[model samples]
Target: MGGLLSILKGGAKEEEPIDIPLNFGAQPSGPEIEYYNAVAGLMRAAPGILNDLRSYSGCGEAIRQAISNPGKATEDAAWAVVCPAVAKLKDYYDFSCALGNAMGAHAGADQQAPVVSPTEQLFPRILSFLGNGDASQNFEQSQALARKLAEILDFATQFDNLKARSASQPAGQPATMSNPNVQNDFSYYRRTVSRMKMNNAQSVAVVSDEVANKMSLFFAHSNPVTKALIDSANVAVMSRTLSLGGATDVFSILAGVSYHMVAKGRAGNDSAFFLRVMVVSVLLYDHIDPAGAFIKNSKINIKASIKVIQSSGGSGADALLNALRFSTQHLNDETTPKAIKQMLAQ
Candidate 1:
């Protein structure tokens, strides 16, 4: 952990010694202290959590290989890889979720300015959303949904263009690309894709459109507390899309899937749980922009560091060690709170 802290600090000069008065009468006690302790605990546990994830990535790769080349691998072989991988993933997710939950509970228990129940509710919901098996499934579903939405968007654009041409044409003059056959084909495809469901005489767009609308709202809204959770979900969707051709690395795929589930809001009640976890986790650990760019950048750096460590033939233990080193090195490069850093040092 010390090594990791050093790495995150980025090789800065050591501070000069200074004489100061000591308050030895009594140690501080209050919600502030509880919050400090919680964040310190998270910092200490982060490397271990990362180590487990690195191991889980290996399992993810084995499962991927087995699935891709089924002719050479049996179903039993695939399950052998998948079952253990899923179990490890679950363990990591549960630990992180629990940490977030404990933090929120402590915060709410404070007598002064107690945290609202809804805010406290977010942690478990975010965890449940990201920790479950459905996350991967949701990523898969999102791909299909995205493609269909793209088609609908294209159709809408084309229809608007056609209408514009018709209106702009001179009287008694033929419009450009105004062939009846082409128009009919376009209408057919559009109607087929946009087919509606009728229940109680109320019409609902296809599932793809509904998902697209949700995604739009997620991106459009600006809620600082839920920003990390939302960004993680977006990353998950992009990562899954990239993995289709096996171009993306295994570690990225894992991170992306975890984020995607929470961001996509596909886990029903689980979504709320995971969002809360993310909000509380950041507020506890990161003092600089708890829900902003700092958290996003930290995630990016962690992923890059993991990739570097794995590429150099590092084992899970080595990865953890190196991650600690890297985190310590860069700690000084960012605006993470000084108090939080000092707490970690202790």
Candidate 2:
């Protein structure tokens, strides 16, 4: 009976079992994931790709050099080197455009972050202003400057907040006011503002009469330190203008103003009042253009402007101004006038 049962079990099991194969092919990725992956791959591949292109360029340059020298190399040999380089260059061009288009499409779809250029990354505030349209582009240019001013205000707010928090804390508890990082940041802020004040003073010296008047008006109700800086700048401008036979070249004035602001920021004395003046002056200068204001029939909003300056009290403001400076420096003179026009329109 045991043997019969074992035979029956074996026979039942012997019935052919069906084997189903499972396919685990690649799954489709989401748009965002695909974009991120593409970006990551590009980032990783960029250095190698650039290096390869450089090598090709070098090879082409070497061939060109050889061809230029007398009896250095035959034309056919040069052509061999040149032709391949040219072909590779064409491939690179195609690849670059394709990648750019892909990235742009992804960004347009809001599926991925916009790919920032090296220059834009270094000067992020300028990114806001980069546009094809006149009005939109012009509006973007001031964004950095405005943001910087706002940041300065934020710093002041932060300090005030810290003070308030400390005051509210238990009497036996330690205060954040004593934190080294906080103190250092505040010190940095002071130094940065002092520098800005020096720059504003310098710019004030070289600006056009109309601009100077506007600046004076802008600072009329500002802190005493700002007023003092403006006075000094005006004196310098008067001397310089007189020496130059009262030449009011807008470009020269702008250049001087920009230079002085940067220099002052680098070398000015650090103080809260000085910092406030610096921030206010720089922002006023950036926004206050006689030509633009005249074209737009606009007047400076003193109360609003004052509020902007007061509120700008953080490290982010400094970063924004730095970016604005970079953008301004890089922009062409022709474009600058247009940008100014746009600012005035606002």
True lDDT of residue 192, candidate 2: 32
Q: lDDT tens string, model 2, 1-346?
A: 3332232123123311111111112232332233334334444443454455333322434444544663426533543444444344334323332232212222222354345353212111221122112312222233333223223222322222222222234322222233222222223323333554766732111233333333233222212122222232233233342121111111122222223233335313332333333333333233323232112122222222222333442443332333233212212234243543343221
Summarize candidate 1's per-residue lDDT along 250-276 as a digit string, tens digits. Answer: 112233332333444443554322222
Give residue 60's error in model 1 in angstroms: 5.2
The alpha-carbon root-mean-square deviation between model 1 and the true structure, to one decimal in Å, is 23.3
Name the regions of candidate 2 deviating beyond 4 angstroms: 1-31, 41-44, 54-73, 102-346
Residue 67 CA error for candidate 1 (Å)? Answer: 2.9
Quote each prediction's TM-score: 0.25, 0.23
Whole-model Cα lDDT of every candidate shown, in order: 0.30, 0.29
User: Can you tell me which runs of candidate 1 are displaced by over 4 Å?
Assistant: 1-45, 54-57, 71-73, 99-346
Which has the greatest lDDT? 1
